[model samples]
Target chain A: MKLKCIVIDDDIHAINGIKSYLNTLSNISLYKAYTDPLQALTDITGGANVDVIFMDVDMPMISGIELSKAIRHKTSKLIFTTSHSKYAYEAFEMNASAYLLKPYTFARFAETLNRLFPQSPSLPNISIQQEEDYFFVRNKNEKNSLIKVRYSDIVAVESLQNYVRIYTTNETIVTYIALSEIKIILQDYPNFAQAHRSFIIAKNHIEKVEGNTLKMVNNLTVNVGNSYREGIQEYIKEKTIRTSRS
Target chain B: MINIKKSPPFIRIQNWLAYKKFHIIIWLVFMLYESVIVGLFSGQFGNLINYILFYSLNISMFYVHTHIILESGLKRKNQIWWKLPVLLSLELLVYLMIYIGFDYLITDILKYFRPRKIGMTMQYILGPVYRAIYFMFFSTGYYFLLKFLSERKKTEELEHQRLNNMIQIARSENAFLKAQIQPHLLFNTLDFIYQNARDHSPIAAETILSLSEMMRYSVDSNKDKDFISLGEEINQVENLVNLHQLRKHHQLQIRFWYDDDIKKVEIIPLILITLVENIFKHGNLLSQSHPAEIKLYLQNNDLIIETSNQIAKVKEKPGFNSGIKNITKRLAYAYGDQSTFESGTTEDNYYKVRVTIKVKHTID
Candidate 1:
């Protein structure tokens, strides 16, 4: 059964943004969206059984923390989506399931959902745009000749000073292109993600995620930066097998 | 000047009234003391009319001797030695004639005994002569005292004004120094860390290097130079973006798009950096669907730096981009009719900034 969700944010833009995020997920569906906190409070308290509630911390009428307290039992899980990191402690005290900081990526949103619902099925192949599965880059070893690099074959891309090393499943390509420029090229691809300050890993090639380190397919280990730990953990959990007994 | 004008008018008027009262009371007490002291010595009391009549003539002579005659005569620098003594002797002679006639009128005509009879006798003339000289001596001292007091006040005012001007000059000089000291210290500390971290922690070293470059650019640009190569500002903007991306682990959804050829165009500095800073401050760059954009290009030889991002839901302090207002004024001063700066919230709730500088056609 798809988990029912409600988004309550004072900004219409934020509510619509949450709506778009909900549209991309397969296991969670939006029941309603609210721009008015007072109306949400009055309606939710009247006894609507919601599976999840995504609320903004800062609202005009009442804070999401205060509103969450009143309707704590109405939903099984509550998540706070705000730009303020200061309210993380308050969210903890309110027993929120998760706190998604505003300006959070779709990957972050999907990751938060997967953590709260570990038993939920994996997300479908959601692509916002249809682009080529591979692109050509001038490999330095080939003497300025362009070689095709598939998106799926990339295990990780590591920055070594001024050059970038692309670790593919078949061959390693060292390009003269800076990692910053390579990042812009891979920005549209969901599989390639920045895991550390100098490393971008393909989410599908991970063999194991032990602590802050990820073991890739080729016995290649990638250390996760502290700030990027959440994104890495979410991807691992999304693929983790959990039974009803657990 | 400031100190002199600080006192209220009402307080000054009260001081003037107090000064006038002090002078009147001193004169009245002196006249009574003279009458009482003389009567005690002689063992006989004089009538009130006689005391009033004599003291009035003496007071009149006291003021006239200094106020009118001495004031004008002493003001003459070259002839004062002869002019002052001659004027004083004439005043005394006129005083003695009046004293003799007044004594005759009182003692002979009215049968009143004179204090000192001035009937062509040496003893009587000597008493009146001594009285006139006593007042004249005091009036001359009073005139010199007034001159000394006024001179001190003039010098005091000049000193105060000079000190105020010096303080103003010091503040203006320190304003330039204040801008450099903090940034100079900050970049030096960053450079120290950059040296130590280069071997072991390349990421930390890279971050520090970018931070130092931006700091150095900011300090150098604040020198108020009229024009600078756009290449330097573009390099600093890239450094700022790289620094932020490092902090965010390369997750910030910001695009810095420009061609290498466009970087050669010369333009003013700080305008592009400030607008980019506002984007990081107030833009929501997390959405892959709505990425924040910073586009720089040349169209029709007009250099345009355009930036736009979706407005964040978080409420910051209002009028946050007041730096944009400063850019408007700076562009107006430098380019006059050749520049146009427009920045505001778009209808789609995106904060956008576009600065276009029209360049004249020139041979490459």
Candidate 2:
């Protein structure tokens, strides 16, 4: 399902900025944009229910904090779009889905959407494949030698420009292969999933998942990229042993 | 924080006996000399009970004479000269009466010893008077010592307070000078310029944005905040790098490497930023193969921030204003012996600066 969102910012340019970013994301669409916060507050409090409400912190008549307090239950997610990180705590207090810092790229916008509503429709084509259980890659660290990498042994793969560093439980092996090429090679295994633009993690190796960071069993942290949050979120939701409650 | 020097003569007079081991020992030694040593030479062994009873009366008179009579008489400074003599006379008369009463009870009433002459004669009064004067003289000296000690302590406390006041004045003066210009106005004005130039001159606007970010960090982070997560400083460092790259037409070769765990490690502000700025100022940034590298990592319990760069054309001590000296001083002030800062050139012409701050976080 496409996420219907509302934008309430005093600055017209800021609203337009959000508008341009929303245009790039296929899964999220802006239903309304309010340059006047008072009108937005009246409309939202009256009876407007949307998937997300993108609010600004510093406004003229009323702040995003005060407005969000009045109509928090109207939206499924409240993503605070602000110029400063000072109001991050306030946004968190209001149970905001994500804190989207201003001057953000299109990828950051998509990341927030994918993280908040992972099951939303129109995400970029992400097809999972399966083939082999193991492969050998040229280890750049050990004199460009071929190293046996069992699918079960892989913890995380990090993209470093043209090289991808594969971290396992015992040691790290740097290979002179692009991350995309490694993604294709590891696609045969169902456990390997891309968490960020530069990171592909083994789902079974995730010791803990806190916010947008994954704690791997090998004692490494991987930051989930904005555009790649859906796959990781889906995997986390499936693996999580939840109590029988909504 | 406020170190006040206090030497309370009677540390606590309410429970004075507990702390007065010196007073108790001196009294014990003097009593031993009078009763045991002098009694041995005289060869007239008195009854043990008589000695004990009479000595207890003398000890009581000693404290009552100084602490009570002397303290009350000298409390009024203007009348102290005459009041002290009157109090001393009253005290002497009271002591002689109590001594006679005790002697009568021990010798005549209880029949512990044979009765002496019961008349108030010169010999009877003279012995008691002499003993009273001796103890009164010693108590007066002890009283004066307490007053002297307390006064000296007051003087020291006043001196310490004055020194602290001078330091406070100096600090506020520095603060007043630094805070003359408001950060809010500076940021808003830059924001205004950035807004005006964005459409026509995008490059200038981008530079302004980066400059404003660094300015905000320096202005805001330095004020009230002593330590911040590496994440905040990393953002500003990236801004600085972007600004330099734009100025040099993207030819500045620099790579900033830091793990997510390293980002959460708290450190004193401006150290990382200053080191980065120093690299840009003195290091050769155009070499593709020898690109400048800044790495932040946690090696066990130590947080290591290392920067290595090639030497520039004219590296005259590689600094931005006060340079690494200010960083060293700040780190010393905050982390003290738990931090180490080293900066110098390697033999192969590469300048490297490594700073390690010892923190309790051991996130590998």
Candidate 3:
């Protein structure tokens, strides 16, 4: 099914720019565009089945942050577009799916969409490895060679276009597999988490948490994406050692 | 000069009498005392009437000398040296003749009424002359006293008016400075243009957006406000770096690292941005191997920012150092002795600046 999206910005030119970009993509359909934020709020609150929303931070009558909070429960994905990067923190606080800076290229826009709705219907061959501690995938470099990746030995999975680079404890494997397929197959595992747009990390491998970055056991520093920060923060809070002065 | 026409006659009279009331009261008391003393010495109640008459005559002579002679003579330039003395003596001689005629007239009238011989001795004429001179000296002192006091009052009034004018000028200047164009309107208009250009020309749209962001930061940060959140300043710094990168056609290498939790910390605005702006102006950011780097973090309740860039071989503009000077001045003003700011060139020709500010918890 094509994702249903709406664009709301006080600037008509900005709405048209986003509309033009969305028109080029086949998987997402632009249902509506709004220049008046109050009308958009009324429509969304009146039970519009919108799958995603592209909102501007600064708007007349109501701020984008305030509107996001008011209608957050009605939509599944929320993406904030703003000229100022300072709103990134507030966007994260509102649990937005992505924060795109103004004048972003089409590629950057597609990257955020892919991360939000990875497992589309076009990729129907993905399947979860149930009742097992390991999965097998074919390597891209050496055809016909199948590699066994133990769930416990997996440190992280990084996406590079159509290929997935699996970092294991002893060696690395480059497989001819989509990141969405791997993400679907590993959906049942609670220990692995998507940390960034191009990265999925194992919770046990996180050695240190510093600001918006995480250091893994293999000394790889992965930046935490704005949308996934809250979950990572909750995980860190649970494991952090609390100290008090006597 | 006094603007006598501005005050009404009644108010002027009230003011004059109020000013001279002390002297008038003192003169009346002295005359009454002299009358009683003379009456007691002569053992005659009739001496009281004589003392009253004498004092009244003396007051008339004093007014004639001061108002008619001194004023009319001193007002003219050539009459002040010689003509003034001649005018004063002639007026005094006329006053003496009138006094002698009045005294003889009074003695003759009394002798006719009582049918008794009244003594006309040399003592009577000389006593009246001596008293007349004494009263003239008193009038001269009083005239100079009034002149000195009025001049001081005029100067005091002028000084008060000048101070009031200065305060009015300062207030208007402050209002003029605060009346700059609102930043929100400028940014909104720029955003409209950016949207229109993005479809056909993405690069142009990006440039407009970046320029608008930089302009918004510089204009919207109210200089009068004391503190701003660090997160907002960081965003502006990033926009500055992006704009400079576009200026060099994406060849400039820059890296910025900031602690996410420090977003809420309040700081004196524009200090970090100024240091980064200086790097773009004078530092060699084109070096791929050694990119200009900015790092901000908190260390033990202090907000610390460090920036380092390679020094360019080209000579900088004469006023390029003013950015750093302004930052130091602002830091000193806000933090006083609590903040530390240092900048120097390393042996490897890398320009570096480090600033550490003591953060207070009360700022929200």
Best by lDDT: 2
Worst 10 residues of 3 chain B by lDDT: B1-10
| Model 1 lDDT per residue over A91-146, tens place | 35555888865444454677788888899953744343338888787776666489
Query: All candidates: CA RMSD in angstroms?
Result: 21.8, 19.5, 15.8
Error of 1 at A124 (Å): 43
Give the lDDT of residue B56 in candidate 3. Answer: 74
Candidates 1 and 3, the one with greater DockQ:
3
The local lDDT score (0 to 100) that residue B209 gets in candidate 2 is: 71
Candidate 2 vs candidate 3: the TM-score winner is: 2
What class would a CAPRI assessor give candidate 3's docking?
incorrect
Report the lDDT tens digits of candidate 2 across residue range B311-350: 8878477345487889999999999999999988898789
Segments in model 2 whose C-alpha atoms lie over 4 Å from true places: A83-92, A98-111, A119-246, B1-205, B219-222, B315-322, B362-364
Tens-digit lDDT track for model 3 on A1-246? 889998999888888878877875778889888999999999989967788999987888999878998888888999988765342335355568887766555556777888888886223344555889998877654553888889999988876433467878876676645566688787788898888756789999998888888988876667776667888889889888898966
Would you list the C-alpha lDDT of every candidate in the order shown?
0.74, 0.75, 0.73
TM-score of each: 0.46, 0.50, 0.47
Chain B of candidate 2 achieves a TM-score of 0.49
